[model samples]
Target: MDQTRIGTFIAVLRKEKGLTQKELAEQIGISDKTVSKWETGNGMPDIAYLSPLCEVLDINVNELLSGEKLPSEEYLGKAEENMKHLMQENQNNKNAGRWQGLVGIALLAVAVFLTFGLSQAKIGWYVDCPSIILIVCICAACVLFSGCRTKYEVVHFLRKTVLPAGLVVMVIMVPALLHSLSDPAAIGPNIAVMVLTLLYAAVAYLVLYVAETRMERRRKQN
Candidate 1:
């Protein structure tokens, strides 16, 4: 009933057979321009030409009309199973993303409190210790959140294994950086923390870049 869709399907199959518009038209006994119009969905082929056109394309009548490749019974069952799995995966990803956002916001609030409250209180060695720890924890959280937003391919394994590794590094670095902030002699650790924070932000940006690349590839493939 959808003549435009039918025409488009015919055009695609014609091209896949490596036949030019003129060649296809001649083989089907139609004007070359008529093939062009059909391919462009501007017009439909005459009912009389439909059967012979399918014969030339080496496709069945149903295939010509539907445009979907006819799958074997076994393949159709597998495809349905895969579709269900993909739908469940998408739902899980959405729930995980929501939870990650909430946790990241909570961690950021804690970081802000430690950075401002402790630094201003000027508790020589004690306050700086916790402040540095909080900042490093924030950085680790940002990395985890970035992984949550990244595609299944790049971050999938890393999110499960390597992200927790980052937490360990954060635990060691934060207190050391905070301790350095209290002592004028050890300013290097404070500077290192700033540099590491910048790098973490850069990593987050890289994740977005990777995600965009994956999106573009999917668009083209589709």
Candidate 2:
């Protein structure tokens, strides 16, 4: 199941039908950009879209999976090959995700260390640097990796964690920030502190939203 070969097949089919990329995408209820990506081999169509797309293009799903026209007798073999390719791809993605998860945890650990080290420094009298860093890092990590799960038995975790914990940190920060801003020297750092907090919140929400939407699409497909 070579993407480039499959993409070329899709493009040829669409052109033979006298349909523009936008026209084909309209029929499939997808963006023209997605159609373009498929044709250009920049990305493969999602599995969920494959059936509808094959229907629109008047091609058998096994033939599309094979990236070529296949004889009826060859359908099972082609499908088996496609399944193997898909499984390998899934495993690769999972490995990559595990590496990313490790990196994220390492970052959190460094943030914790820095927070404690900063607390020991004599540089600030108004701000609780350690507390702020700890709260922000923990919240951001939670939001970013909220979808990660462990094989556990009975506890409902995410509902009692992540967003609620974030809210608690925000509540605590309000008064802490107010007090810190009362000092003239603390004004500059406090402004930066506010910006960092907002930036983290924005990024976390964006990542979470994108993750959730992709998960929903996959679930619908399944």
Q: Which pairs clash in model 1?
A: none
Model 2: per-residue Cα lDDT over 1-222, one tens digit each? 678888999999999999999999999999999999988888988777888999999997778877788887888888898888877876776687679768977987887678777668433443545545765567556645666454121013332343455456666667766887668788677655655555544445555554555455445446
TM-score per candidate, chains pooled: 0.31, 0.62
Question: Against the correct fold, how does model 2 do in TM-score?
Answer: 0.62
Q: What is the lDDT of residue 1 in candidate 1?
A: 37
Using lDDT, give the best candidate's number: 2
Worst 10 residues of 1 by lDDT: 122-131
Clashes of 2: 0
